[model samples]
Target: METTEKSVVRRFYDIVGSGRPEDLDEICSPGLVGHAGAGSNLAELKASIGSFLEPFPDLTADVRYLVQEDDLISSWVSFTATHEADFAGVPASGRRVKFAEWDLFRIRDGKIVEITQYCDLFTIMSQIGALPTAAPA
Candidate 1:
């Protein structure tokens, strides 16, 4: 059970990081849902991933930690990407940005059923020059 759960989670990252968003159907259930401060179903989640990838064509996620228990997997991921196109209304800065996220997934029957993600958006915005920087000491 643990191995299967872990494998499902790993495969999700592999598919997304590999820029094969079209293959998400292989890992995610038709009823898969996402709860990341907002609710999103499978279709919306796929579209969101597409939008993100559009801006960072070279985006990559490095899983720093992954733990599983009772069909639930928790992952701490660090993502790095070069800002080459407009993202969320912010124009491209041609700068590389890194951000961290802690994500939780629930899997059933070898398919991801639900996901909850917590990310450091403020830091990412600051890195992309969207947010103001701290004052120098």
Candidate 2:
């Protein structure tokens, strides 16, 4: 009878937004799949996260809202960090970037079994200089 989806969401971010990469086992399922972005499975997801944040060791996620129902949690969050390592084939630039994202997670057996996430890469890429920005006329 502990309907605490918001608390679960906070706990997840406390580990992910603050803890080291090795903490994935504490939050994600063994075969978790992110359906909205790259990184096919849990292993891939962890590796990708580690590699992406490698350059920006100080990555931080600022949560704006959390919505939950049954065993599902949805979050609206903005993450900020400086690029100091390779990310998605883009070399490090040491540029500070901030981007907002939506993440939907399905929890089962007290762990996240599946995740569907969406984020704006164009904003991040532009902020990191991986993509050219349009100039105002």
Candidate 3:
């Protein structure tokens, strides 16, 4: 049997990279929430995502692992991007950064009902200079 997690992640990346935002509304429930600890709801999550990716217009996620249990699907992803605009209150640094993350999805009735995810915030902040860079010995 094909793993749902792998298929979900693959479709998600394809959609996010090239599909319209409206497509998500069709595949996801209107009451969908992305309460990923730091995020409280889908709206907040969307805004946070906007802030976090403000600098990386060309961001791309590379899938490494995909696992699922019952209705939940999880995937590990590595992303690469170059900072060119403000992100999460940090000015662009023109630095190329790569980071890893996990996206956990909740599926129901053949559609995504909810989603929660985690990412490497430190890598993003440091790359954008919001966090001080370590000094070389």
Candidate 4:
């Protein structure tokens, strides 16, 4: 049971990194609840992912850990991508950035029903020069 649940979460990241957000329907439920303001439906989720992928076309997710407890899986992941296009109104800086994200997925049957993500936006923005970084003393 745990293995199956973890596998679903693994596929989620794999599909996202593959630059095919539409394929996520295979692993995600139709009524999935997502974090970071992603839409509650699969179609909306795909659109949201597509928008993000448009800017960072080469985004890749590296899974650091996948821990399972019953039907829920917690994943610690690092994503690396180059800012090749405008994102969130910020022009592309051609910077490569890596940021960590802690995500929780609830699996049912064989599909992910919900996802909660905690991302390191400060580090990502700082790396892309969208936010000012403090100098080391």
* Root-mean-square deviation of candidate 4: 2.1
Candidate 3 lDDT over residue span 4-76, tens digit each:
5446557766655442444555456667777663265655655555555556877777888878889888878
Clashes of each: 0, 2, 0, 0
Winning candidate number (TM-score)? 1
Q: Over the stretch 1-137, how does candidate 4's per-residue lDDT look in tens digits?
A: 44988888889999989999999989988888887646667787799889989888999999999998899899999999999998878899899999998988999999988888787878878888887677678
Give me the runs in candidate 4 sitting further than 4 Å from their true place.
135-137
TM values, all candidates: 0.91, 0.82, 0.81, 0.91
Tell how far residue 44 is off in model 2, in angstroms.
Answer: 1.9
Please give the lDDT score for candidate 1: 0.85
Local accuracy by lDDT, each model? 0.85, 0.76, 0.71, 0.87
CA error at residue 13 for candidate 3, angstroms: 2.1
Cα miss at 132, model 2 (Å)? 2.3
Give every collision pair in model 3.
none
lDDT accuracy of residue 70 in candidate 4:
90
Per-residue CA lDDT of candidate 2, range 1-137, in tens? 43565666666667666636568787778877777562677877677666666776887889898888888888999989888878778888888999988888888877777878788788888898877677778
- On lDDT, the stronger of 3 and 4 is 4
Query: What's the lDDT for residue 8 in model 4?
Result: 86
Q: Candidate 1: which stretches are off by over 4 Å? A: 37-39
Model 2 scores a C-alpha lDDT of: 0.76
What is the alpha-carbon lDDT of model 4 when measured against the actual structure? 0.87
Overlapping backbone residue pairs in candidate 3 total: 0
